[model samples]
Target: MRPDPQETAPAKKQRRYWHRTDWLSLFSGLLFIGIGVRYLVEPPPNTGVMVLTLVFGLGFAGFFAVVSRAFRKR
Candidate 1:
């Protein structure tokens, strides 16, 4: 017996939340890069701002890498 056409129509796949993680990470990285550039061009009185931007940029890059790896299908 065949199924009803309405029932058999492939269910639209639900989008995974993890799929957005990579894009979020990329955006975060870009934001940090902008801050880093600003600090590089106009050094802040406190060294912490520069350090923070470097950490933020690197951390986001690492996050993107890990998420990309996790989502990769063999």
Candidate 2:
């Protein structure tokens, strides 16, 4: 069957707002990694500095990964 020319507009994909969030996530992750490394190397005594750094590093890295995936095309 022949389709009508007037009804044949190509579908347009919706744009996402992931670019800004992606960069923010990446930067935050790197910062966390740096802080984590620093804390791990010279952690404060009687405090959970090392544990906190590790948690921040892991969480930020995971968030960055998800954001990067979302904005892969950008």
Candidate 3:
């Protein structure tokens, strides 16, 4: 059967600069990075801040890397 001329093709899903699901990922990533930076800028009140800095810094970096990979253009 031939397709109806009146019916148009379904729209293709285009990836935007920021996708809905990625919103939290992106926000968390930035938040962690900010926290990490704060740790670095402020003097270490205790040894825990050092660890916090490392974890958050690395976590955000990895998160951004993964997001970037997923969003890479073909």
Candidate 4:
């Protein structure tokens, strides 16, 4: 089929810059890892610290999972 000789197709859209967004993810991952490592090095004497350590460790694991998926898609 041949038609619409005078019609034009739409132009492609340009993606916005996102390099700065990478820093946020990096900082969050690092922060969680740091807290986890700190807890590993010095066992928390208090129950609150123990709970925080477990949460941050889980957070670090979750961060890696998300980052890996994002990188794979990219």
Candidate 5:
């Protein structure tokens, strides 16, 4: 005889630690903060410099994310 569907137990969801870290949001927030700080400076930074800094920040954030994921996997 077939078992009743309602009698079946629900599957438990697998939890992941990485889900807690919103990397995109973190990166965007940092970018906004940097732009705000740039405005606060007496002499506005050169556009090239600002772009370079943002690129560097992105690289750092990416590296951090990779390291975090690796550690979390352990």
Candidate 6:
């Protein structure tokens, strides 16, 4: 007798649940949104200052993410 096609096929892989959000990327996204709003309302006078702020803000977000991960329950 021939085996059933369904039985011969490999089992499908189930995806694991992702419970936590990526904090660093989340904060970075918010920062960009806020910056976009600010740009539309009142543009920054200096491009250099805006660039510096972005760099520092991302650094701070990264630090926060690391600290959060360190304290999170495994």
Over 1-74, each residue of candidate 5 has an lDDT whose tens digit, in order, gives 99887689687788875546856469868887978887797588788988888888888888877887788789
- 5-74 per-residue lDDT for model 1 (tens digits): 9898989989876534456567676877787687689856477866776777677777877777777743
Q: Which has the better TM-score: candidate 2, or candidate 5?
A: 5
* Best of the two (1, 3) by lDDT: 1
CA lDDT of every candidate: 0.72, 0.68, 0.68, 0.68, 0.79, 0.89
Whole-model lDDT, candidate 3? 0.68
The prediction achieving the highest TM-score against the true structure is 6
What is candidate 3's TM-score against the reference? 0.38
Q: Please report how far candidate 3 places residue 59 from its true position, in Å.
A: 0.3
TM-score of each prediction: 0.41, 0.38, 0.38, 0.38, 0.59, 0.69
Q: For each candidate in turn, give its C-alpha RMSD to the true structure in angstroms.
A: 7.9, 10.4, 9.5, 11.2, 5.6, 3.8
Find the 10 residues in a row with the least total lDDT in model 6: 43-52
On TM-score, who's better, 1 or 5?
A: 5
Q: Any runs in candidate 1 off by more than 4 Å, and if so which?
A: 1-40, 43-45
Report how far residue 50 has shifted in candidate 4, in Å: 0.7
| Most accurate candidate by lDDT | 6
Least accurate stretch of 10 residues (summed lDDT) in model 3? 18-27
lDDT, candidate 2, 3-53, per-residue tens = 987689776788886534555566666776776676688755445765676
Which of candidates 1 and 3 reaches a greater TM-score?
Answer: 1
Q: Per-residue lDDT tens digits of candidate 6, residues 24-45?
A: 9999999889888889999565
Residue pairs with backbone overlap in model 4:
none
Query: Where does model 4 exceed 4 Å of error?
Result: 1-44
Which has the higher TM-score value, candidate number 4 or candidate number 5?
5
The runs of at least 3 residues in candidate 3 whose Cα sits more than 4 Å from the true structure, single-residue gaps closed, are 1-45
